[model samples]
Target: MTDFLNILLRFFHFSSLLLLTGCLTYLMLLTPAGYRNRLEIRLSPALRSSAGVALFSAIALFALQTVMMSGEITALSQPDIWSAVAGTRFGHAWLPEMLLAAVSFMLLRAGGEAARYLLLVTLILQLILTAMTGHAAMHDGWRGVAGEVSQSLHVLAAAFWCGGLYPLLLLMQQGQRDPQDNTAVLTMMKFSRYGHWAVALVILSGVSNTLLISGIPRHFSFWLTGVLVKSVLVAGMVMLALLNRYWLVPRFRQSPAESRRRFIRLTQAEMGLALGAIAVVSLFATLSPG
Candidate 1:
């Protein structure tokens, strides 16, 4: 039950935070200036809601970790145990995570261009802090520092690519409504322009993180199986994205209606695969990497 709760909370936390990061990236960077305000306003409720979920999940994860560390249900009430937990490496990371999460929630609630910019900064910091607590922190000295950096990049790249899909769907809806509006096409082109880099970084840093966490497994293990599954799922998403970009996009003008239906369907599948990948990560993150 404890383990179950741990994975569940981690999934929720990761999903919500990833959503916030990706959607914000899409709004600030991908969407055109004319569409930014409307998109932001439309997305505000979801942004704030994700922030709230992230903050609460961070608190719950901390409490759960305390119990895991102290091996007692009452660890939360024991000052000594709390202090001990706080002194650990996870504690170091969680401290800043909690702080950033709180600030992010407040900023999202405040709502505005300025608040969003601030929220983005805080959320990026929060993602970086995440690298400090997990398998990336296994090494010491320079190697550890390098691992954290790689892991941070991995998280950022993945967040930007996967999280941006939500807004992309919204943008597609607008295009569907106004056949004359080329905003969605232009925005998608913008996303594809930079998204290639994001995808490459996700793959590169993911490999780096895996190597840093545990070298090639000579034997079968749950961790190895999870990694394989995740790789396959990600590969599926990449293939679908390529099909949409190369096969459908060029012919969009020739058959806008058909292209729209296909693109939306493919994008939805990609989102499902992304969620599956996240679920796999959440589960295996708690297991031994070896």
Candidate 2:
């Protein structure tokens, strides 16, 4: 039951991060400066809501973790559990994350150019802090710092690519209304460049994480199986991304309507694969490391 609760909380935590990161990435990187008004009208509410959810999930996860560590659900109300939270590595890592989430939620709700940029910085730091208490933190000395950096990069890259998908899909949907509008296509083209870089970082950091946590071994293991499944899902997402970049985007110039439809479909497919990958990672987090 404790394990079940842990995975459940982890799912919410990861999902919230994806939403928050994706929304911020879209606003700061993909959306055009001239489109700021459109973004405020169309995307601000969603971003604010995601920020709220992210903050709530962070607090809930911290509380649940305290109880889990104490080995009793009732520990939720116990002083000892709170004390443990104050004294542990996980708690130390989570405290800054929770605070940043709170600040981000407030800043997103406030809604201005400076606030949005500040929210992006806060989210980036929060993502980095999240890596400090995970499997990476289990290592010793310099190896531990390397693990933390690798895992941080891995999370940031994954968030940028996978999280950006929902906003991209939404943009595609909007483009379907005016198939001739090159705005969405142009934005996607720009994003594809970033996506390529992000994918490379994710792969390199993933390899580093594996090496740091569980060096290549000949035997199969449950954790390794989870890793394999995650890798496959990520590969599927990349294939869909390539299809959108090379096949669908080019088709937009020739057949805007058809390309818009296909782009939406492909983006949704990629989003599904990303969600599956996140679920697999959450499950793996509950398992013993390979």
Candidate 3:
């Protein structure tokens, strides 16, 4: 029960955090100034909801971890137990995570470019804190430092790729409604131009994280199987992205409506695949590397 709850909460936390980071990154970097204001207004509610989910999940996960560590259901009411857990490495990370999530949620209420930039900082910092407690924490010294950095890059790249899809989907939908809106094409082109780099970084950082955490697994373990599945899912996402960029996207001028529909459908598929990969990671993260 505890294990299942842990994985479930992790999925929710990661999904929300990734979406928050990805949305903001896309708006600030890939989105054109003409469309940025409108999209920001549209996505503000979602951003706040993501922050709220992240904050709640972080607290729940921390409480669950305390129970797991102390092996007592009553640990929830124990101040000493809470303090002890807070002093540990995971606690150290969670403290910052909680603070960041709270600040992010509050900041989302304010208007202007400054708050958005601050929110982005908080999201990225939370990602780094998250990286510190996972498999990377298993190692010590410089190797551990390398692992966390690589993992941070992996997640950051993924946030840009996986999280940016929502805004892109919205843009495309807008384009479909009013064929004259060129922002969709401009944003899509920008995403494609820079998205290739994000995808490349995700693959490279993933491999680096694997190598740093542990050399190639010689035995068939749960961890190995999970990694393989995640790789295949990511590969599928890449192929779909390429098809959209090279094939469907080109037909936009020749057949705008048909192409837009196809693009949206495929984008939805990519999102499904991305969430599946995240779920797999959340599940496997609970397993022992060895």
Backbone Cα, N, C clashes tallied per candidate: 0, 0, 0
All candidates: TM-score? 0.97, 0.96, 0.98
Candidate 1 overall Cα lDDT vs. reference? Answer: 0.88
Q: 2 or 3: which has the higher TM-score?
A: 3
Better of 1 and 2 by TM-score: 1
After superposition, the stretches of candidate 1 with alpha carbons farther than 4 Å from their true spots are none
- Per residue, candidate 1 scores C-alpha lDDT tens digits across 205-252 of 988888877866678789879988999999999999999999999878
Give per-residue CA lDDT, model 3, range 71-128, as digits (tens): 8889999999999999999998998888888898888787888888888999999888
Top candidate (TM-score): 3
Candidate 2 regions exceeding 4 Å error are none
Worst 10 residues of 2 by lDDT: 36-45
| Candidate 2 colliding pairs | none
TM-score of 2: 0.96
Q: Rank the candidate models, highest TM-score first.
A: 3, 1, 2
Checking candidate 1 for backbone clashes, the offending pairs are none
Candidate 3 TM-score, true structure as reference: 0.98
